[model samples]
Target chain A: MRNSFLTVVIFAVLVSATYFYLKSPEIVQTKLEVLKENYSKPRDKKPVDHSKFEVLQKQFNSPQEVVKTCMSCHNEVHKELLDSPHFRWQRPVYENGRGVTYLGKANAINNFCIGVQGSEVSCNKCHASFGEEEAMLAIDANAENIDCLVCHDNSATYLKGNNMNGFPDKSVDLAVVAKSVGTPTRDNCGVCHFFGGGGNNVKHGDLEKAQFHTTNEIDVHMADNGGNLICIDCHTTENHNIKGRLFTVESSNTNRVSCTDCHTELPHESTVLNEHTVKVACQTCHIPTYAKVNSVNTNWDWSKAGKLDANGKPFETEDSLGDHVYKSIKGTFEYARNKKPDYIWFNGTAEHYLLGDKISEKETLLVLNKMNGNYNDEFSQIIPVNIHYAKQPFDPGTRMLIQPKLAALAKGEGAYWQDFDWLKAAEKGMEASGLPFSGKVDWFNTVSYWPINHMVSPKENSLQCVDCHNSENSRLAGLNDFYMPARDKYELVDTLGNLMILLTIAGLFAHGSLRYYFAKKQK
Target chain B: MKEVLIYKGYERFWHWTQAVLIIFLAVTGFEVHGGYSFFGYENAVVYHRYAAIGLVVLIFFTAFWHFITGEWKQYKPTPQFVKEQIEYYLLGIFKNAPHPTKKTVLSKLNPLQKLAYFGLMVVIIPLLVITGIIYLFYRMPSATNMNPLNLTNLEPIAILHTIGAYLLVMFVIVHLYLITTGHTILSNLKAMITGYEEIEEDDDHHKKEEKKV
Candidate 1:
């Protein structure tokens, strides 16, 4: 009887085991299907709008020589702007802007020139107008100053009647004008500053690197809607005005203006930094303004080349050996003869050009030698620079300096240009400085040394939240989010996860209870 | 009259070892599933995994012991009264009914006990083991040809592992409650603890025959 009972129990167990094994797959499948179905339901979410600036298609020309006119009354402000890059145009010089000169005027225009003629209407918008064009008069009527209040009014909007040039009128409300332009935007600075252009155009710097702003698009200082680095983001009109460098000269007059005045603390907080008081000064590390030319400041000294003065005397500058493209010493030159013995130079900005190309050592030295070592590494050096030339097809009157060989001319020893490969030299330099050299070339040459500015470089560009709090500041940073509102929605994976866990727990409990009852009854 | 050695020392050893391991696995496993932390979640997980691995290894040894000793015959179930055992569990369990099958030294567990124990060993344990392994090494993939460890989310695997945990919890609850239903309210419990049980002999003739032997 005991043996038979054992036999019966073993037989029943085998059958039950087989049945459970077969049923498990179906149970697991059903549970998984239910979870998958539940997960498909949509959750409310939105994508993030990260762009801060908008591109305005309209262009406007001012009727009066407003900048010049204002300059007569405000000499200090006039000098500051004149020294700044805004007044200069890197385009070719024109006679009457109509190809009219004493030599029967063929349009082989000069690439660099000083300010525009007073009588021309095309030049008036960006230039100073003398008087009414219909009745040309005194030069005083055309001002040399840039009035801060005109385009900077925050409370105004461009009315149809006020904007005759079909240029978008920068009319703001008087209330906003009473206050400050809502912290600055990329557009506020981009109105005059630009990067990358056609042949003979000046590419001021490399703004196309991904590490800097994650894109190739040039970011005007005021463009960040979320309130990125503005003009005052780093350079303060107060502390920066009285500060050491000209770029950071903070005058009591512009006291409240520092890039830090509005941007405040550093946008990037270090994981190590615990205290706020120990924060660094903006220009303490950023030192000088960026430029493409190896000249004293952004102002190129054309007088260096010997030119016949009005009295027709040979006037040679300290550095110039009378080797340049321009015939007159006072006029700007497109190319310069190499003065250094150990290096080679290339005037290939016109020929093989991309914003960021690697310069070959053999090819570069060959070009440097041809220019007699007077090679400006800012332009001729092996590093890549996307040149943004005069694009409007019209001259803005001021000479825009473009130097290509300044980076390689440092240390004044061992002909560093020849001894070192331009690529290695730059890479090492950037690595040591902890600066990115993807395609951004914004180093300025003052006297013999090149100083890098953090303000102009994308390193200084911000990713701040408050960069676009006020509408007047970030024209696009705020607008882009609205244009494409970001929705942070929950994904289907989460729903499925919840369902699987719930059903699995419930089913297991029920099955176990049933098993317990069966086991208990046989006891 | 009948003298049969139903279980040897090693046989009882393996049975009790397996039972302890299962119980430990269930308790710690639930704790790891964020169910009221006892010994903390991290400690509970460590204990659960250790017990599970021990249990799996014990199963191999137990299966070998069973085969060598022919103890696998104990789980053999008969169809006669199989339906009655099922009905007893389904309906009569609540009515305080008498048990349909009896336990002898040579033939210990009834048809229902055989069936439940067999399902657990063959199906549930293996399922738990597979799901547990997937959970532990879900982060580390050894595929040489695949893209460098692209797994960013762990929620799905976590859910599956948690399901296995819940199953173990249910089994433990029912198993614990069933121990109280034996004769004298503790006979089976005493038998497992001491390896001896007092069997009820209802036939006086059979008793006289056993005494004469």
Candidate 2:
């Protein structure tokens, strides 16, 4: 009796402990209220009204004069800004064969825009520098001309000039923008990042113009009424060097931010869900579909770029959803919104397709990048990606991608936009980039991967087990290297398991029937 | 009816409790293996883990009781009546012939029962419990990155556990059917429940009574 009572006591204690274990991850409403009260919204704690300062009150006649006045007071900050990848347009990388090479926005080849090697004047609009027009390979840029107000401006009216060496626009009041300088806002970062590839939601499917005043359905963190978190909340910057990087321009995994910086590695209420975090990233489930607002550029076929209207002038057409379906100067395009992302195995490292890298002849579909991990790699996890396909020009003889001059440096200087001639544009573009372009130009299909890391959904909208654990239409159906329950079946296990149980049932039925026959005969 | 003490109070308590717990475990365990869903996936996983821990504790107390009272000797197989027990189960039960061996307090199990129970305690139970523990804690991060030994790759361990679970299901079915082979249809179950059975006045008990007198 004593032992039975003790057993019941122990059983109750174990059960109660397990109940609490399942309940412990939930936060009470009152505790969340306290957390919200204590949580510091994105703002500079030290308030300094710059309008009252004596230096800022002076008339800033020109863009260079505005920089000259700001340098007089907050000096030596330009040194940190000069060394950043934002200003230099490249990061110092140690390649496998070549010792150390600078490869990034300037020299790296992407499917969109090709590169910035010979087209620095137009591309330098987002380069975070001023008056460094032809910085294709220039490293020792003048720190005296760094544009400080582009990020520090609180004035919302500042705008960079269109194709004028990244100066403040002709309409911008330089004096007003200089006096309103405080810290970077969502608008300051979104002016370039949100509109990366010429328009909204073009480069990254997760980022777009709607993220400035976003809703919870688009992003849980940056939503205007939700977490209201700015980019730097989880991005945690040290000095002028920001704490994140995108694989499109970067080749290494050293300086990047992750969800684990703010959330724990195992943040789920259930232990089963936490175990999946080891082999799967947080974004793979949280961000089920990207580009929730506007349609992102999915395909670009540059082979149809030379088409003209009846009047011999360039024309453009839009799809039913207002996406630019065809453009005379650029090419044909296909866009999609609320799209499910493709998956890849990544461990933060990337192998970018540099300018001089040779393209393989056997591979019909050339991937610009995205070969950083394998299934056997210990540091790898399945991450979601948005693959943008493009039909771009390539050389048949040398097997290298052709960098055709798309925009004109001088009028009719072999620019494809000016003359609409492929041969001459290839010649001038290769000459400017220091490569020998073959006379023959051919078009080939190319694919590139952009990892989607934003637009987190709410907790209730996360994927269930049936999403990836089912036999059909599994989200992870592409990854077949490992055995997953409900998806993978081994022949030996199925056969042995079935035989063992079926034999037990057959034995019972035969024995029971024979015994009944014998007993009835005896009676 | 001559009612004899065929089971002790503690033995009845543990046997019925173990049967209920094992059936509950199999129901939840198979669901987690993607067989079918009685409970939802999340609930199945949670309850399966809890029941596995409960069975481990139950086995601890059972082994302690068996060792303290020296009742574990009942399950030590002897090859003397092995063939006779097999033959009786195969053919003699249908013809209403006599049993191959007699049951007593000290020797509760026959030759076939001894072998099955011995393997159950020594092999299958331990296999399921150990594999279950590794399955529960697989890929769980520790101070040294993972577990103490840092064992990964859950495929092999899960397969082994799954095989053991199937074998246990087979054992439960066969064991349930054999309970009807006693003197009456439900005599064995009644003996376990009430700690008494209408045993025959056989020579084994007569000899013990003679020695006591």
Compare the candidates by lDDT and give the number of the best one.
Answer: 2
lDDT digits (tens) for residues A286-364 of candidate 2? 9989989998888999898989999888899998899999998789999999999988888777776777678887879
> What is candidate 1's lDDT per residue for A1-523, written digit by digit as tens?
4643454465446545644553343211223234335434432132421122121112224413323333444456544433332222222222222242221001111222212221122222332112223112222222333334333423344221221221223552323232332333333333333321111112233221211232212232322322244344344444113222211111111223334433333322331111111222232222222221221111233333234657755343333633233333232333222111111222221211111223342431111101111122222221111111221111012111122111222333221122322234333433432334443332221111111222232444322212222233421231221110011112343355456656756755675576567668767
lDDT of each: 0.36, 0.79
lDDT of 2 by residue, B1-213 (tens): 478887876687678778988999999887767757688877877788777777776777778888998888778877767899999989999999977776656566788999999899888988898888888777622222545546545678888888888888989999999999998889888988888887666676546643432
Winner by DockQ: 2
TM-score of chain A of each: 0.25, 0.91
Candidate 2 chain A has its poorest 10 consecutive residues by lDDT at A26-35
| Candidate 2's TM-score | 0.91
Tell me the interface RMSD of every candidate, in Å.
19.4, 3.2
Off by over 4 Å in 1: A1-523, B1-8, B90-97, B137-139, B142-161, B201-213
Docking verdict class for candidate 2? acceptable
